[model samples]
Target: MPSIAYILSAIGIAAGITFILRLIPFGIKSILKDNKLIADLAAWIPMGAILILGVYVMAEIDYSSTTTALPYLIAAVVTVLVHSWRKNIALSLLIGTATCVVLANWVF
Candidate 1:
C-alpha cells in the first residue's frame, strides 16, 4: 500500500506531467504563427475556455434546494442586468454578492 507521502508525490508528478503536456500546444503555437487560422484559434482558446467555464459554473447551480443556489442565481441575474445597464462591473459584483449574502441569511 502506498503511504500518504507516496500518494502526494505521485500526484505532484502527475500534475507536472499534465502541465508539460498542456504547454506543448503553447510552444507549438509560438512556432506556427504563420498559419492564420491556427494563430487565431490559439489566441482565442484561452478566453473561450474561461467563458465556457464561467457558463458551466453558473448553469450547474442546484435549484432544488431553493435556499443557497437560488439566491445566488437571483443575485447573478440582477447583477448582470445592472451591469448591462450601468456598465459598472465592481458595483455589479458587490450588489450580487451582497444580495446573495442577504438572501442566504434571510429567514423564510
Candidate 2:
C-alpha cells in the first residue's frame, strides 16, 4: 500500500493536471469559436476516433478460431452496413453493440 503522503501528492498532481486541461478551453475559447478549421477538425475527430477504436477492437480478435471470431465479424459488418444506410454514428454503434452482445450471449 502507498503511504498517505504519496497518495496525497499523486492526487494533488492529478488535480493540477485536470485544472490545467480545463483552463485550456477558456484560454482558447475565442480562437475556437466560429473558426471553420476548428469546426472541420471537430466534425472529423469523432469519426476518426470511432475508426481507431474499431481497428483496435478488430486487432484483438482471435482469428484462428472461426466460432470465436464469427460474432465480432458479424458485428463489424452490421456496424458498417448500418452506418452506410443511416449515416448515423450513434445508432450504428448502438445496433452493432447490441448485435455483438446478443450473439455472444445467446448464439455463441
Best by TM-score: 2
Which segments of model 2 are wrong by more than 4 Å?
Answer: 1-24, 34-36
Q: For candidate 2, list the clashing residue pairs, or say none.
A: none
TM-score, model 2 to reference? 0.73
TM-score of each: 0.46, 0.73
Best by lDDT: 2
Whole-model alpha-carbon lDDT for candidate 2: 0.94
The collision pairs in model 1 are none
Off by over 4 Å in 1: 1-53
lDDT tens per residue, model 2, 1-108: 999999999999999999999999899989879999999999999989998999999999999988789999999999999999999989999999999999878998
Q: Whole-model Cα lDDT per candidate?
A: 0.81, 0.94
When summed lDDT is taken over every stretch of 10 residues in candidate 2, the lowest stretch is 63-72
